[model samples]
Target: MASIARPALLRQVCNAAPTRRMASTFAGSSLKHPSPLTRRPMQSAFATPGASRVAAFHASGRRPILPPLPQVVDGDVNKPAPIPEPSASHGSYHWTFERLISAGLIPLTIAPFAAGSLNPLMDASLCALIIVHSHIGFQSNIIDYFPEKRIPLIRKGSFWLLRIGTVLLGISMYSFETNDVGITEAIKRIWHA
Candidate 1:
């Protein structure tokens, strides 16, 4: 009886003042006069009769429950395992992307130079650049969106990037092809000016 009363008293004291007074009171009471709540129950009729066992619960006061572990909550486990950081293979993958883009840009860059020389054949080079860039851009998307074997909604955006890049690149290329000779000579003359 005295043991159980101590917890209740400490609880009250703690509730009243959550300071050194409550901490000291709890420490003093728990060590010197252990509460009944802390004591193990003796074997009794409550132990054998399953229905009567519930009666014991009603008699004893409810104990304050401790907070749950930080990771789990509301029946759903919340912590997702961290994704592994990129590896050496990541460097290789980046290299692959660089190579692809570099290849596409090469023809595109040269087509402009040829156009500035007023070569009508430069239009074909421009077309080649735009087409190859579109094709390579689509391939890059394959690396991104097809890794898991299925097309994710994310891949949908790739189509747009490829289309826009192709159209804009082609238009830029075609314009330079037509105006190359006069534009180049004018820029040269301006530099002399």
Candidate 2:
């Protein structure tokens, strides 16, 4: 589904039951408003201390899984606030990168058809874009599966491993383009054989 559709659905569901008569409209739907009985405190079902950890982790930026770090005993009430890291995936840079990849889909799909005719530069460009695209995708998966806060060593190691692999693959692609047929022509020849 397109990204815009999700927000539109949310809007519809949110505005659907503004009035009592409109509440009946959503009667048979899954997006019905909650009742008073279901308005209890959002507690974990297990009653274990760890059960609420996920909720707390999400509520605060810090992780609840690990023990808290010891604070400095020095009374420094005027201590400056720590600087926040610039977010790569939240602002304009993220949107531009996303759109560039989306636009490149056309070239990625069409270039393979005429692979034998494309120049080495074009082939190398396509290969680099594909590698970068794949790296971004894999990085996202890594971020989701192995967050740095939870597993610092594994996360950093995995990211560096991916970077090294991408560089090696890019070099190999360039060598292949220089020595023999580039990626598109090679794949085309494979299909013919």
Candidate 3:
């Protein structure tokens, strides 16, 4: 009698609306929005900190991990090509400190000489200075992107310098040059030349 009642109870439970909905939507259906259980398992994928962390890495230009190539021979030393070390990577110079000082020094040293001679000749000199300084600063500044963990002051300061120093020099020089063409000179040039 107890065994007979078990089937009846099971049949009633199966016929229940809530149980049918649950089984149809969850137990059997392969196509559906992620359920809470599924989401719980993959929550990290949508997690605030996790998503932002991955995004920060992407913004910082970091590469995601992948497995190494399969080995063709044991201790062969030729299966996988060794990555070429960066040209400046193992060199003696501290890239960031060198970069920061150079970035500032190049412009600062130049702007004064340029300020002292704001003639048309200074125009060519200024252009040349911009090119040479830009090249040196750019090469050095890019090393800040490396993940080897150099000091922050070294990198960040140079980064700021790359952003602002060129513009500041331009502005200062413009004022100096404009002041050279004074009101009397301007009148004379307009009336005379």
Candidate 4:
């Protein structure tokens, strides 16, 4: 078959398309003819005038009159609020410490490999840093899954247990540093073995 030009095809398609118009009809008894209820006022003339429905409710000894609600967009109506978190004051400092410690770990890790061993002070410091980092990670996990509000005892107990474990591990690490190979050398031995 021969191909039709684009413009000619478009013209033929447009010409063949049916024109559609929408039609709407209303009932004879619609708003064009007013109802009896619309012709009369809803409330009595003797009812409280120049008063809101809520005010009228107050006048009738029903609801107590409350102060006007604060507007949504008014800055004063919505004052500068305190942070909603319970420990907001301490949170930023804690986060900064966590970040500083994480940064330190990069150097600490590289130093051990570069030096091929650790001095007693470096060994103990690295051990403490690792323990602290691990404790932070475990504590964060416990906080996420077991909220203090729901299980206060469990949360506190878990944190204390982590602290105890860290201390015990630190003692073991120190003992190894004095009596045997330190952390770096021990890792090297394991890998070589």
Candidate 5:
């Protein structure tokens, strides 16, 4: 009895409605009847009329799992790559500055200990160089981890935070040198203690 009723129910559902509808109801009478392939799906009766499409990942208002890639203009593959404009600051100059700081550190680091006393000027220079080296290293890490193109907000925030931290450290180091025993002296005391 149940097997005979199931086929009757299936037939009713299959023949219930037309697959295609007149477009005059939704679209402004320009299209009389749209083909089944081009017709839009009917909205759920419970869904709001003005509801906007939302991303599945960002539905809960959290950051995206993966950052979006930067847009690149596609060009002819046969064409040769364009030459980049010359800029010393972005190229050799920045690298040269970092190398100089690194090289200066070895001598400045040795001079105070060799002399058995810290000259205030030499100590200050050493401190400044160390700070600059650390800042450069941290800036590189931030750039690598949080790229400006993909995650601009995070990258800018990290940069500003780094700047603030560098400034605070410089101020504190200056105060430590002037107000009390200098960096070398403090390190020596700590080493002996």
Candidate 6:
């Protein structure tokens, strides 16, 4: 099939009128001739002459007048805002700990193969770190997509699900390491196979 030029294609679309099908869709609808209420300009309660409507609303006792907003005092313009106290469990410390785990994994991953033997402790540590890293990544995703403010129930459910899954994964990993070949040995066997 021959392709039309961009300009010609645009001109063809712009010049085309609405089809019979499109016009017929709205033929029986009130949309063809809108009501006078739709034609009139919108009036606000605060605007002049519209204030009587506000009075009428109050007279009818439908809704009470809202209280004024609380006044906020401005501090010095040049001075910086007060810094929040840091906690070890969250904020920068949590981020630094995650980074440390990620950096530690690189050496732990290479050391087993390079040394030509799988240390059980190193294998266990690597597996634990990977699980923690995955949990953190999934937690970040849950926080981004299902925020507490937007979908509180879903966010709580996802967090609980993540916790449960991580626990199950850890239990399974422990079982795998104890009952059969550990992660490193399994990988080596698979690689040789």
Among these predicted structures, which one has the highest TM-score? 6
Query: What digit string (tens of lDDT, one per residue) describes model 6 on residues 157-189?
Result: 999999999999999999987887889889888
Can you list the residue pairs that collide in candidate 1? Answer: 3-35, 3-36, 4-36
Q: What is the Å distance of residue 35 in model 5 from its true position?
A: 33
TM-score of each: 0.29, 0.53, 0.25, 0.52, 0.56, 0.58
The reply for model 5, stretches above 4 Å from the true place, is 1-86
Report how far off residue 55 is in candidate 3 (Å). 46
> TM-score for model 3?
0.25
Candidate 6 residue runs with Cα over 4 Å from true position: 1-31, 34-87
RMSD of each: 16.7, 16.4, 14.8, 21.0, 12.1, 17.1
Residue 78 of model 5 has an lDDT of: 80
lDDT over C-alpha atoms for residue 113 of model 3: 48
- Give the clash count for model 4: 0
- The CA lDDT at 31 in model 3 is 38
lDDT of 2 by residue, 1-193 (tens): 4325556444433333243234233465434335322323332233324322334336555555866554444448886766768887767888699679868867766866754546777777787788878888888889898865567788999999999999998888778889988878787888889
User: Candidate 2: misplaced stretches above 4 Å?
Assistant: 1-84, 87-90, 114-117
Per-residue lDDT of candidate 1, residues 75-192 (tens digit): 3477576687979766779678657666766765665466553344544554564466566667677666554324444466666666787778667656765666433344545777
Residue 168 in model 6: shift from native, Å?
A: 0.9
Model 1: weakest 10-residue lDDT segment is 14-23
What does candidate 4's lDDT look like per residue over 1-193, in tens digits?
Answer: 1114445444423322211011114344234324323322333333424333334335354444653433346357657765666775468888999988888888878987898877777877787798889988998899897666566788899989988998898888778888987788888789889
lDDT values for all models: 0.53, 0.65, 0.48, 0.64, 0.70, 0.68
Model 6: lDDT to the true structure: 0.68
Q: What is the alpha-carbon lDDT for the whole of candidate 4?
A: 0.64
